[model samples]
Target: MTKELLKSTLAELSLAENSTSIIGIKRGIERETLRINNQGRLSSLPHPKKIGSALTHKYITTDFAESLLEFITPATDSAERTLNQLRDIQKYTQARLDNEVLWPMSMPCFIKNQNEIALAQYGSSNVGQMKTLYREGLKNRYGSMMQAIAGVHFNISFPKSFWNRLQVIKGDKTDSQSFISNGYLGLIRNFKRDLWLISYLFGASPALCSSFLEGKESRLPFEKLGKGSLYLPFGTALRLGDLGYTNSAQSALKVTYNSLEEYIIGLKRAISTDSDLYRTIETHSDGSLKQLNSNILQIENEFYSPIRPKRNALAGETPIDALTRDGIEYVEVRALDVNPFSDTGISLQQVYFLDVFLLYCLLNDSPEMDNEEQKISQKNLEQVVNFGRDPSLELIKKGASIPLRKWGEETFEQLALIANWLDTAHGTTHYKTAISELNLCIEDSDKTLSGQYMSALKNSGLDNGCFALELAKQYQVKTQEHQYLELSESDLNNESAHSFVKQKEIENSDEVTFDEFLTAYFK
Candidate 1:
C-alpha cells in the first residue's frame, strides 16, 4: 500500500466519526444513601445516582502506520531496568512515608499502597500478605515500568462533608453536592482509567516493543510524545468488572502482513478444512446470522449500547460492538481478570501469552466470516466458554461428532505455526516458549495461572478472595527468592541514583486536572 493509503486505512479502522463510542454521565437516585437518610432524619432528599465522568481515547494513525508496530518504542532506551531501579527506591521511601507521614494525617485505612491496592479487610488475615506479595513480585520482576507511563490516577469522589451541611429548606440549603454516591463516582473514574489503559496498551504495546525498539531511529512526531503527536488509536476504556471492558477497544491494525480480501479467504479455509470448527445455527426467514423479520438488528438495537454512546446512562446496557471498519479495527481480547487476588491484576505469563496470541491473530490474519459462517463461529465461541476443557464438546464440520479438544489442538497448531514464523522474522525465540506454554496448558491444567488458582481454591477450602490472597503471598516468596540474590549492597545504598530517576519522571508527567486528563487523552 502507498503511504497515504495506509494512513487512510488505519484512520478508517479507528472509526473516527463513531461518536456513539463516547461515554457520558447521568443523574439518578442514590440507593445507598437511604440508610443515611433514616439515621439523620434529613428533611432534604438526595438524588440517588449521579453521573460523574465521561471517557474517550483518541485514534493515532499515520502515513507510516504499518511501520508502527513493526518496532518497539520506550521513553528511555532501557525502560525495564530504569523503572525497576526507581521503584526499588520508591518502595523503601514509601514504607517510611507511610509510617511517618501519611498515617498521621490521611485516612490510613483508606490509603492504597504503592501497588494501588487496598489493604485487607477485617477478619481477613491474608489480605495484608497478599498485598505484600503483589508489591514485591511486581517490583522484583517488571518494576514500575507500566505504571509510570500509564499516567496519574484521579479519584472521583463526592464531597460528603459538604453534602451533610445542606439545609432542607429551599433558601437554607445551597444544594451544592452532586447527586452521585462516592462508590459510583469511583466506578466512573475506574471506567475512564480502564478505557485509556486498554487503548494505550493495545495499540502502543505491539508497536512499542516490536517496531520502535527494533527501529534504529525515532518515529515519534517532532521527536516528541505530545498528546496529539500521532493517532493514539488505543487510549480509552469502559470497565465492566470481570467480563472485560471494551469501550476503548477499537483499533485499526495495519494489514502490513495481509489484506482484508486475503483474510476473508483464510477464514473460509480455516472453517472449511476443519469441519470441527463449524456448526449449524438456525437462521430467521431472512436467512442470515439471524432471522430477518425478527431482525437481529432490532434485538441488537434494544439490548445493546451504541457502538459508542453519547452519554453514560446508555452505557448501562451491553456495550458490545461487532462491526469491523474498512482497514484496522481493534481485536477484542476478552479473557482478562483484575485478579482481585494479585496486586497488578495479571501475571507475566499471562502478559507473555497475550503478546504471542495477539501476534498470531495479526499475522495469521483470519478473514471476516459471512453471516452463516459467523453463526458457526459464535457456536464455536460458546462451546469454548461453556465446555472449554471438556474433552467431548460435540464440534461438527459437516455434521459429525468431533471432539472439542481435538479441534482446539488443531487450531492451536495453526497458531503455533504462525508464532514460529514470527519468531523467525523477529529473530526472537522468546515467543516459541510462549506458544509451547499454551500447548502445555492443553496438556496439564496446572501450567496455566487460572488452573493454578482454581486448584488453590479447591484444595485450600478458601473463597476466591482468600485464595488470591494466599497465592499472592506464595508468589511474593518466590519472587523474593529469585530477585534478592541479584542485588548487591551497593545497589541498595544508591539513594542519589533513585532521586535522579524520580526527578526525570516528575518532569515528564502531565500536570493536569481530571478534566484536562480526559480531554487531552481523547483529543
Candidate 2:
C-alpha cells in the first residue's frame, strides 16, 4: 500500500495515531478471530484486541517558507530513484522498439469460492488472506517504506464467457457447456457485452515491425513470435492488465509509493470522487444504501492513486510513458492467487518464472499495436481466456492446434532462452533456474501451485475456506522464511533513509493545502 493511500484510509476510517493496525474483517467464523470491540463493528480484516489508545488533540501551523521548502525538496530518495528507474527503463525500451508508447490494460476477474469457511464471513466484500499476503510482501520487499506505497482495492465483474473464450483458445470449443457465462451473478450482470468490449492488445505493432524489418518474417508482430520481449511466451498468462497486483484482478500494482504527496496525487487520478464509473449494488435500505455506497467509493478511491496532474505537451498519450518520464515504473502483476496448498504464497520456482518472464518483456524490443489490430486482439483474447487449457485452442497466430499443455511447454523453452541471455548479461543464473523449474513443473503437475491448490481442496472435501485459510497460513510461514535472506541490513537501511527523508519533509512542509498544491501544479 502507498503512504498517501494509508493516510487517506486511516483518515477516512477515523483511525487515531495510536491505532496500531487496520484489519479487514469479513463475515464467517473467521469473524470470531477478527472481531471488533465497541459496537461489534465489522472490519475488512481481523484486528488484534486492545489497539493502543484513542485520538488526542493535534494541530499544524502552515507558512509560505515551509511550503516553498517542501515544494522544492522531494519527499524521499526512493521517490526520486523509483521515478528515475521507470523513466530510464521506458526511454531505453521505447528507443529500442522505436514505437509509440502504449499503456498496459488491466483486466478484472471475479472468482467464486465454492465453499466459504463461515456463513457470516463467506462472500463478504473483504480481502482476508490476500490482505495479509500484501502486507507481508511489503514488509519483506520494502519494510517500513511499504507504508509509503499507494494503491487501491477494487472489484471487477467479467462474464463466465471470459473463461469460456480461454477454453476455446485452448481448443475445447466442442464443450458446448463450457462456453456458458451464466453462473456468477456478478459477472452475469456487470459484464454484459454492451459494457465491456473485450479485446486483446497484441504483443507487438505490425506496422512498426513492417517498417523496421522488410521480410516475410514480419507478418503482424504477434504472429508466431516465439518468446515475447516481455520474456514469456505469447501464451504465458501475464497479469498485465488492470485486474491489479500487476496481474491479479484487484492488485495495488502501478502504485507510486516513494512519497506521500505523489501517492495522494496518484490516488486522485485513479478514481475521481465525481466519476460515474462507480458501481453500486442496492442491498440495504435506500438511506443506508446511499451512505454505504458513498463510503465504499471513498474507501476505494483512497487506495490506488495517480500521478499529480500537470500540463502535458503530449496530452492524450499513454500515462505509463508519462509517469515513466517523471521517474515512476508501474509494477504490474496480481492475478496470481497464492496456491492454497503450497507451503508458500507462491514457490521459488514461480518467482523465478516471473523474473525471466518480466525480463523478457523488458528486454525484447517488440512493436506496438494499431487501432484496427487492437480490436481484433480483443476477440483473440476472449478465445484464450475462456479456453486456454483446451487441447485445440486456436491461437491468434494461425496454423497452431497445439494442446494448452504443449503450448505451455513451448513457451517455457523460449523463456529459457531469455533466461540464458539474462544470465550472460547480468551474471545471474536466477532466471535460468526459474526456467528449469518451470519445465520440471510441467512434468510434475502436482508440483504446480494451481495443481496443488486444486488437489488439496479436493482432498479436504472441497472446503474453500479451509483451503484459503491454510493457503494464507502457509504463505505467512514461507514469507517469513524467504524474507530473512532477501532483505539485508543494507536494504533495510536504504528503506530507512527513504522513510527518514519523507518524515522530515512532512515535518517541515508548509500549509499549502493539497488542493492548492494541485491547482498550482497543474495550472
Candidate 3:
C-alpha cells in the first residue's frame, strides 16, 4: 500500500476499535557491561551477588565479557515498564556496588591498562564453561578492544491481535506464525534499507579515550581531547564505523531478508561453512574443542548485523534453530548506540519513535534486498556512522544518489503522519513530538545527538573520560534515588536468591561433559 493508503487504513482501523488498537509492542534490551572504580579506571570486580546470578537470572546476565553486563527484560508492552525494569536492575546493581560506577558511554573511556581487561569467566558447569569459552573465542578472533565496544539491542514484536487485523486488511490466509514471520522479515528489509537514518540520528559514540585506540590503527582526523580523549569532530558512532575486527568476516556472509526460509538457509550454510583463516588459528591441541568450530561463524550469533530475527530459544536450541523452528517471534534492532544523556541510556522519545518507525516499516513496501543493494546499504551505514553530520553527504537509492538531508526530511514527512496515527491510537502526542524533535536535527545539523555531543565535548575540553565518568556516577545516583516502579526491594532480593538456586540447578542437571556438549551443540 502507498503512504496515503496506509494512513487512511490506520485512521479507519483506529476508529473501528473501541479504544485504540493497543497493540502489544514487546521490548527486550541487552546492553554490554562496564564498571569502574573511583579513580575512573576499569574495575576488576565480580558480578555482585545481590544483583542476581549472571548465569540463570532472567533480568541480569553477562554478554561478551564478565564486566559486560547484559540486562534482559521480559517482553513488555509498555515501554516505560521495560525501562523501569531495566532501571531497577541498574539501581539495585549500583547500590550494591562498593564504589564502582557503570560506564555510561558505548566507546569505553580510559582503561588504566588494556592488559588488565579480561574476557568473561563463567563457573564449572558445562553451559557456563561454554559461555566463557565463547568469550575466549571472541577475544582470540577479535582483540579485547574490539570486543569491549558496547551498544544496545532492542527486540520488538507485535501482538497477535495486530497481526490478525493486518491479515484481515490484506486478505492474507497463511498460518499466523508464517504470516507474522514474513511480516517481520519485511520489516527487517525496510529497516536495513533505512537503517543509516538510525545511526545518523541516534548514534552517540562519536569519540573515545585515546587509551582505547592504543596499539591500533586509525586513519580518521582525530583531534586530541584533553589528556585522554580522541574524537572525530564529525564522527557519528565510531563504534559502528569501519572498526577493523568487528565487520571483517561477517561482511562476507551476505545474508538476505527476502524470506524467512531463505534467511535461515543462508545462516545454516554459514554455520557449516569452514574458514581457512580460522583453521590457521588453532584453539586447542588436545582432542577437546577449540572455538566451537573452525567455521565462518562459531554459531549463528557470530554473524553480526545491525538488525536480527530472533525467537526465545527453547532449552538446548541455538538462536537460529529456535527462529527456524518457531518462526520469527521478534526482530532485534541492534543499531542503537547507548545514549549517554539519559539515565537509562534510552529515553521515552527514543522508544516511542522506534514504535512509529517500525510500524512504518511494516506498512511500507519492503522489496527483497539483493547483494548489490545490501552492499550499498552497508556503505551508506558506514558513511553515516562516521560522517553523517556532513551537510553535503549523499546516500544511495536504486543505484542513484540523493542528498542525505533531502532523503531524511522526506522520510520524516511521512513519519509525521505515522506519528499522528500513533497519537490518535495512544491518546498522546508523544510520537509526534519525537518526530518533530528529530526533524529539527535535519533542519539544523548541530541539533543531532552526535553534533550535540561534539559541541558539549568541546565545552568540556574535549574529554570523553571527563564526561563519561561524571555521567556514569550521575546516572548511578539517579537510578539509586528513583523509586521502584514495578519491583520492590524484597522482590528484587527474592529474584536474586531464586536465580542463584536456578543456576545451581542448571549446574547440577548437566549430564554431558563440556566437550560432548560443544560437539552436540555445534551439530
Candidate 4:
C-alpha cells in the first residue's frame, strides 16, 4: 500500500472509529547476567526466593539459564504505562539479586567457566520437567553459550474495533478471525522484509567475549578489545547473525510466510517432524525424561525466528493449539537488542518508533515471500548484521541493488506519511517524533545504537566486562531512582511469596510419572 492508499483507508475509518486506534503493547525483557560478585566472575547462587518461582511467576521467570531473568509486562494500550510496568519489574528484580547486576547488553561478557551456566530448573512437576528438558535439548544441540544470549521481545496487537472498522471499509465478508489472522500474516511478511533495517539501526550486540565463541572462530574477523573480548568493527547484532542460533534441520524446513494457514502448517509439521540424530535422544535415561519429544522442536517455541505470531494460550494449551483455534491475537518482535545505555535496556522513543513501524507494516501491501525472496532476505539480513555500518553497504530491493541509505530514505518517506496519520489518530505527535529521531540515524550511522556502542567502547578503552558492568551499575542506580505508581515494592514482595506456594502446589498435584507423561505425549 502506498501512503495515499493508507491515508485513504484511515480517513474512511476515522469517521466511524472516531480517530481512536487502540494499540496494545506488551514487553518481555530477558537479561542474562554473569551473576558476578565484586570480582566480576560468574556467581553460582540459586535463584533468590524473593524473586518468585521461575515455574509459576506471572511477571518474572527464567529463560535458558537460571540466571537469565525474563520480565514480562501485562498488555497495555499506553506506551508510558507499559514502560513504567517494565521499570518497576526491573527495580523490584534488582532489589532481590543479592550481589548480581544485569549484564547491560545482549551479549554476555564474562564466565568463570562453561559448566557454571546451568539450565534453568523449574521443579518436579511434569510441566516443569518438560521445560527443563527443552533447555537440555537446546544445550545438547546448540551449546549453552548460544542459549545464554539475551534480548527483548516486543508484542503488539490491534483491538477488535480496528478489525471491524477495517472489515466495514473493505466490504469483505470473510470471518472476522480469518480476516485478522490474514492481516497479521501480511504484517509478518512486511516485517521480515524490513527487519534488517531495524537490526542495522537498533542492533546493539556488536561485541561479545571470546569465551562465548567456545573456541569456534568468529564468522568474520573480529577486532580484539582485550584478551578475551572480540567484536566486528562494524557488526550490528552478532547475536542475530551467523554466529547466533542455527539449526540445520530447521534451515531445511523453509517455513513459508505466504499466509496464516501456510505458517501454521509449517510450524505443526516441524513439531512432528523427526531427525535421526535427535531421535537418538533418550526420553528416559535415569528415571527422568530428556526432552518433550525427539523432533525438530521440543515444542513450537523451539523454532527460532526474529518474529513470531502469537495467541494467548489457555491452560494446558500449546501455542499452536491457541493460534489454530483463536487465530493470531498479536505478533512478537524478537530482533531487538538490550540497549546497554538505557536504564531499562529500551527507551520510550524506541518503543514509539516500533509502534509506527509495525503500523506501517500492517497498512502496507505485503507480497508473499517466495523461496528466492527468502534467500535474498536472509542474505540481506546477514550483510547488515556483519557489515551494516560499512559505507558501501547495499541491500536488494525488487531485484535491484539499492544503497541501504537510499532504501531507508524511501521506506522512511512512507513512514513519515504514516506517522502523521498515527499522530492524528492518537492525538499526539509522539509517532512523528519517533521518526524524526531515526531520520538522524539514517544520515549518520554512528548515531545508531550499534554505532554508539562501538564508540563508547573506544572512548573508555574498556573491555566488554569493564564497560558493560559500569553501565550496568549506572542503570541500576537510575532504575532505583525511578518511581512506580500502580505497583509498589511491597506488591512485588507479596507476589513472590504467593508464587513460592503456587510452585509447591503444582509439584504436589503431579500424578503421572515422568516416563508415563512422555509415553502419553508421544502417542
- The global Cα lDDT (0 to 1) of model 1 is 0.27
lDDT of 3 by residue, 333-444 (tens): 8878888887777878899889888988887878888877888988998888878888988999778899999989878978998888778777787889999998898867
**What is the lDDT, from 0 to 100, of the residue 275 in candidate 1?**
21
Task: Give each model's whole-structure lDDT.
Answer: 0.27, 0.29, 0.80, 0.81
- Candidates ranked by TM-score: 3, 4, 2, 1
Clashes of each: 41, 75, 3, 1
Error of 1 at 67 (Å): 38
Evaluate model 4: give its TM-score.
Answer: 0.95
Q: Estimate, for each residue in 177-252, the C-alpha lDDT of model 1 and write its tens digit.
A: 2221222222222222122122212211111111111223433221212221111121111111111121110111
lDDT of 2 by residue, 1-523 (tens): 2223323332332323212221110100000011111221112221111111001001011101110000011112122232232222222222222111111111111112211111111111122222222333322222222121111111112223333433443355544332221112112121111011111111111101111121225222233221111111222222212211221212322333333334445454543343232243333354322222222123231342211221122532333335334422223232243222323223344444544554333223223323243334434443433333233554443233444456456556656765665455445577787678657654554444334433444466523332333433443344334422322434433443454454345435535643353334333
Error of 2 at 464 (Å): 0.8
Task: Sort all candidates by lDDT, best to worst.
Answer: 4, 3, 2, 1
lDDT, model 3? 0.80
Worst 10 residues of 4 by lDDT: 24-33
lDDT of 3 at 397: 78
Task: Name the better of 3 and 4 by lDDT.
Answer: 4
Task: Indicate which candidate wins on TM-score.
Answer: 3
